[model samples]
Target chain A: MKLHSLMLAAGLAATASMGMAEKIKVGMITTLSGGGAGLGIDVRDGFLLAVKGNDDIELVIEDDQRKPEIAVQLADKMIQSEKVDVMTGIIWSNLAMAVVPAATAQGKFYVSPNAGPSALAGKGCHPNYFNVAWQNDAYHEAAGKWASENGVGKVVVMAPNYPAGKDAITGFKRFFTGEIADEVYTKLGQQDYAAEIAQIRASGADMVYYFLPGGMGISFMKQYAGSGADVQVMGPAFSFDQGILGAIGDAALGVKNTAHWSKDLDVPGNADFVAAFQAEYGRLPSVYAAQGFDTGLLLASAAAKADVADADAFRAALKEADFQSVRGEFSFGANNHPVQTIYVREVVKEGDVVTNKLLGAAAENHSDAYAADCKM
Target chain B: MSTLLLIEQVLNGLQFGVMLFLMAAGLTLIFGVMGLINLAHGSLYMVGAFAAAATAAATGSFVLALVAALIAAAAAGAIVELTVIRRLYDRDHLDQVLATFALILVFSEGTRWIFGSFPLYLDVPAALAGPVTLPGGIEYPAYRLLIIGMGLAVAAGLFLLISRTRIGIQIRAGEADREMIGALGVDISKLYTLVFALGAALAGLAGALVGAIQSVQVGMGEPVLILAFVVIVIGGIGSIKGAFVGALLVGLTDTLGGVLLPEFFALFTEASSAKLIGASVASMAIYILMAGVLIFKPTGLFGGQT
Candidate 1:
């Protein structure tokens, strides 16, 4: 009996050390097929690239189908059945609203790779939740800042009439102080922007700032170019990223945009990430991919420091955010959202493909506006 | 809004409605003749856009792209009818709906597998690129004007084909009495296949034209498909005239409502909130119209009771 008890104690110690590092299960729920699938696919590819051949972690992925209810269901299954230590990889803001609050309320760690709803930044923020991506307002705020610095007069701003869209306008307005032209709230996933383009022309705004991510961006940029309006275009970088830039073509060229990460960031970490991503995916890595890659590195670094089962230790380790980010010099705010340097990029033609060229930093070490509202 | 802006908005509404008419016309024709509720109609639209994009990229000809769209969509429709849809014609509506829903997944995945996950770019031909200022100094895309003209022409041609041709008489007979038409040796199955293919071709043309304006990507048809269903429901189940009129009404309501509602509400609320609320309400305008129409005329404006 004495010998058996001694062996059991030794066995527990071995399992504790081994299980702490290797047994961390991550549940990545993302849109794999739908209108918004490209962003989610980039995130998944970048994430898988980071965790590739690392025996220290295991991942279970499911498609949310860009549906919020489906996202919630997947989160439930991931938490209850698979026992994931962390959850991440949501695309749309609507889906994030449904999934994030519920998962975090249940004491599970959620590191967002893409979507970061404003609600999560403030009163709804959780100690267990960390957004490796910028706050919802970061890039738009940078756009507003850039416009203000550039002496932009009269701008017409627009976005879909949704929470994230509202957040985008708020962020843009927070920085841009100019003559009010008109604020147009378009339909979500609207294909034809002829009416809106006409309105933009009629408004006589010197420039147009619109946030219609994914396919909407492609349609809008194309139509605006075709309209021959010639007014300059400005937007958050998501609307002019590597993913859909090819579709927009020359329409996107010379457009100024802002982002937290770029493929051409000129940092050693980013260069390696860009090279490895191209080598792996046979395409230029989107900003979404960089965030996903950062997420993977974030989780790995935290796990290396302390067991994810210990909530206090794991949370502290993540707060440190010690991993080298592709964005360079990424840190967590008091609210656990990224405080990173937002860069301005110009849409340029690199050979035959349309991609963004780094202009300069728009905002340095930018944290969210709502960080003060965060209690944790 | 100024009168000039209002006039421009009216044109925008007409353009939108005309496009919706093309989709509704095909959907209504298929439903009227076949009694099959095909959810996969959107998949056909996607196929058409993909075919056009691929052809344009390969051949650098818009005309060829349009031709490929028509042929590819028709071929897809005919093959689907022959393989799976034909069997469901004798079955219930639930089975038809289920099978077509499954086909949406199959076609979407297959297209993605072939063309990849990225969107394909199809530029408007240089002849139609950029906006031309109209009589009132309203600048509009030449391509949009072309779309409006093309939609009206297709509607007229479809009307002529249905009312003036011998094929039209046989189709009407098949709709009224399938067994009698079969007994009359009308080759009912062939007629059905041809009708389905024709509808599919029309959808393909719509997709091809719109693909240049919109992003040519997978699942692009689903939103348009829902709008088409709304158009048909409001126009009556199987009436071409109903589809045309209904399409126009929906188009006008959606477009005008989107432009005017925010302005109307802005008088009472903050412009931002008003715009957001108004835009949402505008999105539901067609559905609300459909509900009102169904409440008053259950058979629709032109549908007949069997």
Candidate 2:
């Protein structure tokens, strides 16, 4: 009996060694606390759901408190102590800029679930870094293109004063050929937009396009409803994100916005992703969550193709972009940023919940403009 | 630049200032009576907001939310005062500062555990949901006008309460000399609890009123807290009259500086650079005004001994 048991154990060990699935260690640094925690929670939950039932991968997640310095420290700890195979899940662009360069410098893989700052897509592009989400300017550029195509006569563009905001404006101007009425930059995280709303009302612009994210978006939408502004409102989908939509309520209804993916998108994997996310989280997935789930799918596909032990092979495999993306036919541009379609979504009431419904494609097979600046 | 626009901007400034007064009144009162630099005063504001949000979500009544905010904040203040704050009263300001700072962490984390990470949503009641034309034909948000009215009414009520009430006299006596008030059978400890609860209720009321307009999140109170400190500094510690004037001054300076500075700089520079510089300078204007006030009248406009 002992000899028979030893033989069975030896046979199982040999089969395990033969299959030899690659083990990948993932360190997720996200904003899990404070005002912006909702976005991070969605990302983390989506990533975990995508990677569920896979024993070959390990994830260590930490909260950065939305601070750049704390993010840097978390990156260092992940690199030296945890010795992670890949680093992902930074929400804020500032935190991404702080951590990505240093982490990618050490030849470790960095997959951005969000925060695809233009600097990285251009001269700052790193071979080890892959942006699974749209570049910071892609949605803004799409909105601008949509605005121009719709024959918007006079329009005002506004954003918070920051690097991402600059990127968003630059993107918007790339497509908008209309007479720009005004270019306004509000203070980052400024709660009250009554003053700015009044300015927009007085400017006599036919339409207003803005790029305020997170809680700023909530405040602006609520205040905008009461601003008595007659101008049409449009923006990037960040403002109408699912995590914040409940707070915004009917204020955002009928407002058009642009994004890379939506639950209503009739893509091959999108329906499944939306259903699976709802099943797992009991809430509709935000764009952030969709990007996070895609990040997992991309990493799983790449890890399946090449051994993480071979850095060049793994990097080459990642560039292949073999995953069935939630956005459909997702591929990386020369800058390692996403080359995908941008959709126009209208905020609508779904039963009691306020959410988005698909309008149509705004930008198809769109590649970021900064790809020409990248060597790889 | 137009007179109508300028008038509208001034109203915006005044509206902003009035909100600050709500926060400053409670903070200044607490500091004056207790001599405690309670950084955790902001926690009370957050407490009120969360309570209001939760109550509004469950009850769907704006009035119920306000009452819940008041009761929750006052009850929390009383509990904190009895259990933790009473011990810090005899300690130095540094100890008080450190202890209260610790309380902020506890309150923030505790609230997070109860509320989760997402900001709770509160809505403006339908009655005040639209814009109303002012006397000058300027289109203004009725909700903001409501805020301004509530703030002014609270200011008047606080004045009446402090001057025409027996509890107000005891509070004044407690501020003057805690030992003397205690010797005179004023039940000084009970007074401290009552005063702390009152300050907390005021902070809660401010939070509930503003939560409709702002993101009702965990750390929303800190920014308002910093400005409230400025309001107290400029108004004179412990003087309700000082808090009101100082709040208006800070609010106006911040708003007008934000608007006019860009136009003023546009004459000398490009519009974009003008905006960049104007905004940077505008944010500094309040602090600059605060410094000037300190240099000229170190005790503040209405402050005496505090």
Candidate 3:
């Protein structure tokens, strides 16, 4: 028995010494097979592309179907069954809120690739939680600032009636010190926007700012074009992303949107990312994809610098954000969310394909308003 | 809100109602004749939209796209009725619901597999694109006016077919006494298939018309399906007339409620808070109307002894 124990001890010591290259398991809960699947797919593709040759990171992706309950269940499974050291890849803010706090409380590192809800960015923030993406209100605030700068008066703002939707309008209102023509809150998954378009036409607004994301945005833009409402339409990049711009077609052309990253951003790693993403996925990458790529780089950098088992060291490394981001110079704020420049992009047709052309920074080196409330 | 805006909203409500009527007409007919609840009817609608989108992309012909939508949706419906729906005809409502719900999953996943999750573009044809000014200086999309006209024409044609044709006699007979119609040698299964196909075609037509304005994506049918169900329930299970009235009422309530409620609440609250309150309440307006209809007429407006 003593001889056998000595042999086992020697084997364990050898394994421990060889554990420097240990794989970090990341569980991604994203909408993969539903209406919102396009965003999640881009995020997954970009993340996978960034860590393509690096075998040190193992990603287990689950389709949340954009459901909060399903996201919670998946987060539980990731933490308990899969025993993932890191969790990420949630696109919707509600799903992020459903999964993030619980995962962080359980001593698991939660890295947000897309969603950055106000609650998580504020007092509910955890040291183990890091958001590579901007806060939920960042892009909307950028649009507001852009609109205010351009002397856009009497703007009609609209969004779906959900947490992020409320956040979007609130953010826009914060920086837009103009006469509000009207504010419309629509159903979460409503396709038809006839009623809303009629209201916009009659409201006599110089510009219409809407935050309808995914298919909702596509529907709204198409209908708005057909209505010939004679109002300038604007929104954040979520509505004009590369994944959806083609679907929106000419209706989206010349429309201004705000985002932290664009395909045409004159950043160090952005050109390579754009080329690599197009080569890999046969399409241009969206801001979500850029965020996903950054998240992968962030995790990889932390893993290379410090062992994930050492929570304090891993957290500190993640905070450093030592990796090169596609969005140019990127860093985390007091709230653990991105402090980055948000660019204004106009939807333009580039050689038969609809894509965004960078119109310059809407808000440079901006941080979230909620950072003051985050203690950690 | 100005009088012109109200009138425009009414027109928008009418267009929405007419679209719902197309969907409800099929659903009511299937439930009336088959006594089988096919939850996959929405899948047929999705099939139609996808068919239109694909054909439009390939041919760039709006008329051809619409024709393809009709044919594809009818063919899909016929196939589903022949292969799976017929089996559930004699089963209980719960079983039919279970089977059809499974078909929804299959259709959703299958469509996603074929067309991908990205929404396909299907814009209104140039001739129908852009708004047309009305008598009261109110401008409305010409395409919406077309939808309203087409819906009315379809309703009239359906009425004529049901009240003044041989198949209509058989259908009414089948609805009244299925076994008796079969005993009288009326090829009941064939009739069922024809009715199912017809219903599916109507749904597909609605899908095509709406797809021009909406995103043609997977799971687009389900939301409209719920509203269609409310329409059929409020109209009466098997009554086409009931479906028409119910659809119009629901559409007006939903559209106008969304517009007017916020204005009404704005009187009592701040503009932003009023919008929030009005929108939340407006979403519930249709259900409230449905409940009111149910309270007054449990069997539905036209649902009574045949």
Candidate 4:
């Protein structure tokens, strides 16, 4: 009996070692604290929800605190100590810029859940870098296109003065053929928007276009409503998200915006995602959540296609675009950025909840204009 | 170039200035009386916002939230003084800065652990929701007007308290000479606690009020804290009057610069070029104002002579 038990224990130990050897490890670094925490948390939750019940891939997570330097350090630790097969989840462009190059240099696959900086979409793009989201400038470009098509003649544009802000304006101008009445840049994360609103009111523009995200967006929308300007207000999806709905309630009502996904998307996959997320978290999922969910599906699909022991094989599988995304029939271009639709949305009152409803879809699987410069 | 635009810009500046005053007052009082550079002042502001938000959510009353914010901030101040800040009174400025910076990290992490890293929302009461027309035929937010009014009222109340109250005499005495007051048999430790609590309460009040206008999230207090530091520096580190004046100056300059810089650039360049240049300069406006003030007045507007 003792000899039989020893043989069984030896066999079990061998099987466990083989399983461990075959498991793929992914390192996820995101802003889990500070001002960006809300979005980061949503992204993390969405990714985890996608990976639920998948046993092949193991995810190691770290919080970067939204600091660029910390992101670099976390990347070093993930690469050197953990020797992760792939790295993912960087919500800010600054953090992505700091870490993605290092991950790619090490030949590790770096999947971005969000934050499509212009540099990565263009000449600086790397083969090992894959973004599951649209180019940072893509949605803003759609907004500009919608504005120009809708007969907005003279418009004032505003954004926080940053690299992303520049990308937003450039995207807006790519489609907006109308004469710009004025363009204003404010400090990043500025709490007050009274001055900008006043400027917009007096600029004599037919419409105002802005690209302020998170809290800055909330502040701007509140102040814009208060300014009582007769001009129409429009922006990208980040300006009016589920996070801001509670704060900006009636103020953000009737604000026209543009995005790839709205809570009210009519697709079966979207309906499932929304229902599941609401049932689990008791809140509506934002576009950030959808992006995050797509990322998890992408990773899991790649894992199923290739043996987790081989990093190169797993990456190749991911690049094939085998997963069914929540965004329906999406694929990555040669630049490893997503080719997907940009939807124009309007913020309207949906009962007690302020939500964005899709107005029209524009530009299907639209590759960024900057991808030509990318040698990769 | 238009008169209406320029006037609107000026009003924007005034509104911004008033907001800054709310942050600076608490900082100046603590610095003047305690002779300590409390870097964790921002954490106090954050604490106030979180307390107000949580309380409001639980009670479904905005008034209760405001009261709770004040109480929580004051209590937190007193506890911190007893536990951590008391040890730093004899330390150098660098040590104080380092310790307070650490405090900020701890406070931010602690708040995240409790709050689960999502932003909380606060709504402006219906009474202050809509817009009112200003003198220039431009409609402005009633909430902003309320903020401006609240800031003025607080400033007035501070002035009266400092000048007319008996505890104010002890505070002034403490500021003048801590050793002398202790020698005079006053419970200096308790007095210190009171002053710190008072300062914290003011900070909490600012946080709760601002939370209504902005997202109440962790680290929201940091930007306001930096602005408050600039306010105190420009106003005269320990002078209430200086904080008030400096806040308005900083606020107006920042707001106007953001509006006018792009327009200024438009005269010499295309709209796009003007925007890029204007955005860059607008961010630097407050720092430029600070530099100008320092060059002219070495001690700050209301700073006492060394």
Candidate 5:
């Protein structure tokens, strides 16, 4: 009986030692299957690529399925069950809003790979939350400024009728003080834009600004081209980025878009990123990929600065905003959102690839307008 | 609006209506004949799209990809019918709904397992790549025109097949009285398989055609499937003519609502407020239409006898 008891005690000590050596857990939730899968997949791949040689972090992946309820549920499970030290990779603002507060409430470090909802950027900002991407409305605000500077009068604005859509229109209107001919909102996943195009033609708008992303953007662009309207069309990066280039093809040519990072940006970090991503995926890295890669690097930098096993320490380290992103030098604001550049770009046919080329840099390390509301 | 723009919008509405019809026809047929609501029908559409994309990527032939899509979707339908659907024929609607919902989970996860969660894209064929100038100086995509033509051809073929053939009589009889027809020596099981495969084939064709224009990935079918359900519901479930009319109504209403609502609001409110209100109302137009229809005609416009 004595020998059996001694064996049991030794077994418990061995198991405890093994537990101490286990990798630090990180939870990553993103939309991995659905219409938004392209962007989410790229972000997931970029994050994985960033952690290629890192042996300390163990990633636990979950798919939110592009639903806010599911995201909140998953965030809860990640925090209470999985007991992850940090959480990351939310693609949509609605989903981000659902998960960010929950993760932060649990005192887990939450790093956003893509979404930067205005609410979290301002009054709702949490110390445990950190966005590696720019504010959701920042790019559109830059586009509005560019349109004003270029003398684009009588501009008609359109976006899918949703919270994000409203944010986009408000962002555009922030800087453009021209004659607003019309503002139109369509269903969030609308596949047709014929009637909208007809209205744009009838309204006599000189240019049309829109903020449709992913599959909706492709469908809208195709129908817009079919409408035979000659009015200039423009949007932010999400409307005509690398993901939709293959689907949109020549239809996207000459379309103006605004974004933070383009494939052709001349910085050495950008060039290296573009080359590495192209070499790895055989396609140019999109702003989504760049943001995701930066997110991974950001996490790694924070981990290096503090003991990742100590969750509170890691969270504080990330909040300190010490990392180099491919979008050039950027730092987190008090609201846990990045102050980043936004560029106005034009879609052009270069060789066989249709891509967005930088037309002009519109805003430099610009913070969101809602930053004032965020008392973080 | 300019004449050209009006003409283009009309064509767009027609094109959208055609796509919705492709989805609705199969749903109405299955519901009419089987008396079962199969929510997993969208899973078949996703399967067809992924199959087409994978085959096309491998062979570099759009024609082969389309053929593969049809075969794959049909095969999947038949297998699902034999394993899961056959048992649910006599069950209540609640059971059928639950079973099909489970099937959706299986199909979606199975698809993800095979495709590794990446979107597969199919390219538009060179034969129908560019925009063609139509009458009234309106430019339309040749591929879209092809889709519209294919939809019409299928509609005509379905009408002929239902009216002019011996199997058509069996199908009609089966729809009217299943037990009596089965007792009369017709093999009902084989007939059920045939109908399911046919419905799956139609859905597959729609998926393959649309896959060229959009990203082919998991869960691509859910939205269209819901819209198709709305079409069939408005058209009267199990009625092909109703499906066609319902699809067109929805297509036009949804397309025009987005454009007209904001302008109407602009008359009374600021431009931004008008847009917000108009868009919100436009998004709810179809649901409002559905509710209005249900209030007056509880059985749907052409739903034979509720």
Candidate 6:
């Protein structure tokens, strides 16, 4: 009996040594405390749901407090001390810009669940970097296309005065091909929209396109509703996502927004994702949640095929993007950003909950314009 | 822009200025009367907003929401004043600042623990949810117009209270010389508590009013607090009249600069770059005004003491 037990122990040790269980350490730095915490919480919950019951993957999560410097410090700590194999979960573009380049340069793999800035999609693209979310311009570009194709004309464009804001306007103009009545750049995180609403009402434009996200969107929608502005409103999904829809209330109803995914999309794995997310988090998932779940699945698929120790093999495996995405027909562009169909969604009241209902596709096989600028 | 549009923009400026005045009033009052720099005044504003939002959610009454805001903020101010703030009266400015800053963190975290991080839904009352036309054919938001009226009314009430009431006399006397008032048989600690609660109630009222139009979430008060500080500095630190005028000046500069500067640059440069340059300058317009004022009069517009 002793000889048999010794032989069994030796066999188990041999199997473990042969890499039967692969462990991948994941470091998630996100805004978990502050105004932007909702987005990060959703992303973290969705990511965890996808990797549930998997003991092989260890995730180290830290709150960034919506500060770029804190995010940089966390990234450095994750890379230097935690020695994480992969890093993810940055929501804002500025924070992503602060953390991603440095992490990727230090030989740490970064899979962005959101915030695909133009710089990273273009000349600053790194081999170890993968953006599971759409490029910064993709949704806005799709919104522009939907506006132009749906008989909308004479639009006033507004965005925060930042790089992503500029990218939003540029992307909209790329496919809009309509009379641009005016372009307004407001201060970032500004709550008051009275002046802007006054301008919109006076611009004589039939439609107003804006890209204010998070709480700013809520403020704008509420103020715009009260102002009795006669113009129609449209924006990207960031402003109308499930997380903030309740706060916007009925003001967001019937407003059109473009996104790469929706809760009602008739796609494989989407219904399951929505149902599972609701079951786990006891709430409807937002677009940010969808991106995070897809990111997890993609990482899982890559990890199943290749060990992360082999950088070249892991990169090739990630490039394949073999997992089923909630967005459906997902593929990575040459720049490692997502290339997928963008859908137009309308904010609707379903039962008692405010959510999005898929309207139709705005753009098919939509790829970013900056992909050509990437060398690798 | 058309004349009507420009007039509407000015109204927007006035509306914004009125809101800033509400915040600056309380801050200036506390600083003037207490001789203590309270960095946590914004936290009191946040507390009021959260209280109002929660009350509105529960009872579905706007008036009840406002009342709850005032009561909750005043109670919080009294408790904080008695428990934490009373101990810091004799400390140096740096120590007071550090302690109040710590109080801000505590309030922020405590509120987050109770309310979560998502912004609460606070809508304009249905009666005031439409546009009101002014005499010049300028359409303005009725809610904003109401805010301006309320602010003016409060300003008038505050002036009257300061000029007529016995407590106002006591407060003025305390501001002048706290030790002298205490020596004259006045309960100085109780007066200090009352003053703090009064300032907090005003801040709470401002928060509830503005939260109806803006996002009611954590950190919402900090930006307004910064603006309030700018108003007091540009005006005079301890002068309510100065706060009122300074808030309006800053508001007009911010709004008009944002709207007109871009238009002004359109004549000399292309539209997009003009917007870039104009916005960059406009964001600095208030700071520039503050600097210009300081360069001319280092003691501020209405400052009396060195």
- Quick one: best lDDT, which candidate? 3
Model 4 scores a C-alpha lDDT of 0.82
| lDDT by residue for model 2 (B57-89), tens | 998999999999999999999999999999998
lDDT of 4 by residue, A1-376 (tens): 0001001101222233234335568888887777777788788778877776565667888888788998898889888988888888899999998889878988888889998998888988998889998889888888888888888899988888888987888889898899888777778888887777777777799999999988888877766666667789888888888867666778788888877777777765888888888887888898889988989888878876777557677768889888777777688888889888888788888788878888878666677888888996
TM-score list, all predictions: 0.95, 0.95, 0.96, 0.93, 0.89, 0.96
Per-model DockQ: 0.71, 0.67, 0.81, 0.67, 0.49, 0.74
Q: Is the docking of candidate 4 incorrect, acceptable, medium or high quality?
A: medium
| Candidate 5 structure quality by residue, lDDT tens digits, A143-240 | 89988988898898888888899899889999898988877777877765657766777789999999988877877776566556789999988888
Q: Please provide the root mean square deviation of candidate 3 (C-alpha atoms, Å).
A: 5.2
Worst 10 residues of 3 chain A by lDDT: A1-10
Candidate 1, residues A1-376, lDDT tens digits: the string is 0001001101222233445564567888988876778898899889888866554556888888888888898899888987888999998878888998889888899999988888899989999889999889999999998898899999999999877888899999998888768899888889999888878888989989999988899999988888878888999988999999988888899999999888888876889889999999899999999988999899888877788888899899999998888888988989999888999999999889999999999999899998889997
Q: For candidate 3, give the lDDT.
A: 0.90
TM-score of chain A of 6: 0.94
Mark the regions of model 3 whose C-alpha exceeds 4 Å error after superposition: A1-21
Q: Compose the digit string of candidate 5's lDDT tens values, residues B1-306.
A: 466766666677787888889888888888999998989889888888889988987998999999999999999999999999999999999999999988988888788789765455576777776678887766677888988898889888988888889788888888888899999999999999998988888898889888777657677788889989999999899888889888888877777676667778889998778878888898888888888887887778888886
Writing each residue's lDDT as its tens digit, candidate 6 over B157-228 gives 988888899988988888788899999999999999998998888889999999998888888888888889
Which sections of candidate 2 miss by over 4 Å? A1-20
- lDDT score, residue A234, model 3? 93
Name the candidate that leads on DockQ. 3
What tens-digit string does per-residue lDDT give for candidate 1 at B114-179? Answer: 988788888788899989999978888899999999999999998899899999888788778778
Sort by lDDT, best first: what order?
Answer: 3, 6, 1, 2, 4, 5
lDDT measured at residue B67 in model 5 versus the true structure, 0 to 100 = 97
- Location of the lowest summed lDDT over 10 successive residues in candidate 5 chain B: B115-124
Give stretches of model 5 more than 4 Å off.
A1-25, A56-58, A278-283, A308-316, A348-353, B1-8, B51-68, B113-118, B123-142
The C-alpha lDDT values of all candidates are 0.88, 0.86, 0.90, 0.82, 0.81, 0.88
